[model samples]
Target: MNPDIVRWSYAAASGALLALAFPPYSVWPAAVLAPALLLRAMRRAETPQQAGDLGALAGFLFAALSMPWLRFVFGPFAAGLWAFFALGPALFGVLLKRLQGRGDWLWVAAAGVLWAGMEAARAHLPGLACPWLSLGYAFAPAGPLLQAASVIGLYGLSAAAVAGGAALALAAEGKRIPAGALAIVAGLAWGLGERRLELKPQGRPVSVALVQDESYDVERLAAMTPRDAELVVWPEYQAGVPGGMVDRYREHLAGLTSGRKGVLVVGAATVDEQAPFENFAWVLGSDGALLGRHDKQHPIPFMEGRLKGHSDPRPVATPLGPVGVQICYDLDFEDGSRRLASRGARILAVPNLDPASWGPLQHSQHSGMAPLRAVETGLWVAKAASSGDSMLIDPRGRVTARLGFAGRGVARGTALLSDGGLTPYVAWGWLVVPLSLLALAAAVADALFGALRERAFLVYPPSPLGVEAES
Candidate 1:
């Protein structure tokens, strides 16, 4: 086969494999194979630009295949979004190419760090941070492996996944030592995760009910509320209750908890005299008293018309426990949930809205993030989604109960309210991003220094006898 054709084929295969690693296909091994193939393709590149181009090709394909749901919202313009996300992978390829020729182990380690650094950067980009389909999420369905997120957050898992992939690529090139070392490390992590899963969770068990309805009708949802539940949640924008009607709706919705001891968490909209509408989650006590409200901190850019919430997210004190509320997109990022966990949140209630028009894949993919958040915070997650996939996830990242996509019903489950301290991820996992950044900087500096030395040597050649040539 022609070398260029072979490299292109590998890049294309890498993208396809990665796409399959996410829902609804969810072939987990494909996630590992994806990066390995991309690395192989890049290895064949004669120049950094060619490597970056190959990386971009793989990234574009992965984004296009995995996020077709964007088409429902952006139409043909979704192609532009895919291309924008491709920049991360393109940068990863350039860095990997430059960092090569370090020991195989160091190169492998740098590959993982560079990939993770780029992912962190992409996720925090000023106006366009989309953290969808991260490599770590491919393991979300694996209960034992997912527990690793409790100690290292999603970015750490992403690093491990990419490192494993790089190791695999090296193994394929007949390099066994580094590959075996990484495999052993991965095995140990898995063992620890399984052992962690065996430990019993210490917390107060409270019955929770998630109302999943598309109509967002207050009366309909109120009727569906379970009276015995200690916590009742409705999906985001549950009526888009106008700013002026929030008080009236709160009074009426509180009727759901009339005879029960439950707290009602309803998703709605709020607007002040000066600002436009803000996505808000209302916490109502049993007697119709307003406990607190959390505005959606990370509103979907361009797609959502609401103003970005500026308030710090803290748990609202409830009779059940301190319940933290994260509106749909807020859960996609680490900041809000980690802050809540560090501040002593006992349980998390997420009100999500995924229109059926966006497709079931979108709902499933979005719901997958709940498990990661659950493990990271060591709190039970009660996610109420408008169109479906409302679920209850335990601290171990296990989906205890769920309602399937495109359904209108209530998901009932027990949530354990943590009296424990923040999980390691909530407390210290933030170090992963900064550490990765520092490691990348070192690798780039090493590459530049090596280049500079080579150029200097060429400018002043040494004689065959090891003496400098006379000018």
Candidate 2:
């Protein structure tokens, strides 16, 4: 086969592998192999610019396939979003190729760190950022591996994956000894993770009921009675009251939880005649008193329209321990969840409202991320999606019970709720911050070296006729 054709084929293969590693297909091992294949494709490039172009092509392909659901939400703008985010992976390829050119084992580790930093940068962009599909997310299916997240967070796992891929690529190029050493280190890491998984979680059992309905109808609560529910949750935006109907809405909610001993966390679109509309989770106490509110903190970037997000999160005190309430998409980020946990929230009551328009593929993908939030905060997550995929997840990233995407149903289960304390992830969130700085330094160094190398080969004062120099 032609060398150019082989290089392009490898790039395309890398994209396909990465796409399959994410939800729907979720082939975990493919995530690691995709990075290795990308490294191989970059090795065929003669210059950093060439490596970047190939890397960008691979990234574009990966994003285009993996995020097809973006089309459902953003329509034609999805392609532009993909193009923008693909730049991160393209830059990663440029740096990895330049550093690995030295053939030093140390650079291999650096390459991995660089890749992880790239993922963090893509996720942290101010207004327009979607950090889904990180390399660490692929390992979510492996129970023991996710235990590391409680200590190092998700980006740490991404770094390890990138490093492992680099080691595998090196081994394929005949650098066997170093690759074997990395394998041993990885095995030990996994063993340590298993030990963490085996440790019993310290908490008391709390019976929680998750209600998933198309909308918050009076009949839905009137017809059903929970046997033993310490807390009852409804999906996000299920109760949208008119600007003049706050009093009536409160009266209805009061009636809903009047006799029940459990607190009701119901999603609402609170309308005020004086101010802008706010998305909130109204916390109604057992006696039908309004306990407080947890407003939606992280709404979908473009889809949210004009709805605003709250910056600080406060937990609502309840009989089942302090309960933290967040809406859909907030579970996808670490800040709101971490804040809720830090402020003494033992169980997270998530009211998700994934519209049927988003499709089953999006539902499955969204559900996969809930467990990671549980593991990161050491808080048992009770997620109720209106369309489907209502679930109960423990602190160990275990899905104790789940309802798939299709019809509306109630998910009733007992959750072990811990006394609120900061997990390692929340207490030490600075691990990735420094790693990003190191990656930035590496990229600057590679650019300098590449530029100097090109300068050395430049032909100045081209021919005897005072022609322009060849770059």
For residue 232, what is the lDDT in candidate 1? 86
- What TM-score, over all chains together, does every model reach? 0.92, 0.90
Error of 2 at 201 (Å): 2.6
Model 1 Cα shift for residue 114 (angstroms): 1.1
Query: Over the stretch 1-471, how does candidate 2's per-residue lDDT look in tens digits?
Result: 898887889888998898898889989878778887887878778877778888898889998988888899889999998898689888887777677657657767776778778877776666765667777878778787788788777777777777777777777888777678877877887898799788877778778888877756645753453635888888888776778777688778687556777878888885564667688888877777888888888767776656777889989887666889889888887677877887888889999988888899888888888878888888889988888788998888988877778776778888887665678897876556566757667686868887787787684433644443433
Tens digit of per-residue lDDT, candidate 1, span 282-397: 89887879999998888687766457655499989888878899999899887788889988888989999999999988988998788889988898899999998999988898
* Pairs of residues clashing in candidate 2: none
**Runs off by more than 4 Å, candidate 2:** 216-227, 244-248, 271-275, 430-438, 441-471
List, in order, the clash count of every candidate structure: 0, 0
Model 1 clash number: 0
* Candidate 1 C-alpha error for residue 446, in Å: 6.7
lDDT, candidate 1, equals 0.84
